[model samples]
Target: MGHRVLAVLLLVAGFVVLAPGTACACSCSDLKPADQMRLSAAVFTGTVVAARQVEGDPAGPTPPIVYTFRPDQVYKGEPVTEVRVASNAESPACGYRFSTGGRYLVFASAEKTGMLQPDPGVPLHTGLCMGNRQVALGTGPVRAGDPVLNGDPISAELVDALGAPKPPSAAPSAPATAPPTAAPASPAASTGGSAPTWIIVAGAVAGAAVVVAAWRLPARRRVRRD
Candidate 1:
């Protein structure tokens, strides 16, 4: 009986140690090309259908730029379950292509195009000019062929194409300062206009009188619990 109990406890301990290895913690850049193929449902190999520049919203920190990808020379490489756009080390304008790893939303785009335009729209497609259909990353719906304007388009895709870059432990900005606070209102302010000394004394006396009256009541007696 002792051995059986010990064995059960050992088994439980082993499972706890090994469980985390099986969990999905994949980041986009962490996955290799082979993994990308295995995981994605569809893939696209096309030039930037549309790219644009945008200002980072000061109200928002570091805004993201978006890109519109249209299928041009569509070769169905392993169904892309995920996508990433990598940025260039030399420049922030053009991004490389990247793929996703195990964790969702992590993307990398590794290849960079040096200022290339999308193939001119064929007669079958007619509407907004090729460059006009960009959307802000956090602003709108994401669907195939939707125009996207990345605030820092190249950087946006580059990070997506590559894995997320190492994060700096702290921002370069000066540390935040505590805002000035007003002094707490005095008792006079809290009581509305000026209150006379007699009124304050009377209030204190009345409160003490009530407390004394309640304490003296016969029901205040406690019954001993044996």
Candidate 2:
């Protein structure tokens, strides 16, 4: 009887430790390298012309803020991406910093942006660095039009300190582009010269004024002679 009780106690303790581990495994899984590179390039360096915040879960849980990334250049690589990172939203501890119209470096392995969400119920926004690469915001607050990079000078030095990351197996290939169309010629091209239209008008006006003055002077001399 005593042996059986001791065995039961040991089994329960093992289950207790293993339960959290299993839950964490389901919750957090790090992203792959290729997906990380593609998303980082799209959001960080890409020019955003427009954006708006999306509200979430008023009666449910936490409200979500969503910002869109519009690409100036073509996204040459991946079809999709996803990531979860800390943000500048209001929390119980540090309060709110970023409201809307802000640019952030999102890190994720999968190619689905909408799937990305903040870690539930954690104060103090934690930055998401995908595939060992972290976001570096500029000095002062992170705002729209701020430059973001995977590894900057300071982060590059840190990478050197920590040893270099292993390079990805293969680089993403750029999409094929069609040949550029030539511009049509305009009819105005044939008349191009240095002299402007306003100069010609000014000269004609000056010539007319000089002729009038010469005619008036001759008439005045004739009247004086008479």
Best-matching candidate per TM-score: 2
Residue 42 of model 2 has an lDDT of 29
Candidate 2 lDDT, tens digit per residue, 1-226?
5534432332233222222112211122233434334333222212223323335544532333333332221222232232222332323221122323343333322222222133333221222233222233331222333334434322332222322222212446798898899786543443474456677789999999999999999899999999
Error (Å) of candidate 1 at residue 218 is 99
In order, candidate lDDTs are 0.32, 0.34
Model 1 misses residue 19 by how many Å? 30
Segments in model 2 whose C-alpha atoms lie over 4 Å from true places? 1-44, 48-51, 72-127, 131-226
- Expressed as tens digits, the lDDT of each residue in 1-226 for candidate 1 is 5534432332233222212112211111232333332232233433344433334335532222334443322222332322222222111222222221111122222222112223212211111111112332331222334433432232333223323222212325787999999899876787786896778899999999998899877455653331
Q: Estimate each model's TM-score.
A: 0.22, 0.27
Clashing pairs in 2: 80-111, 81-110, 81-111, 81-112, 82-110, 82-112
The local lDDT score (0 to 100) that residue 192 gets in candidate 1 is 82
Candidate 1, which segments miss by more than 4 Å at Cα? 1-29, 53-56, 75-226
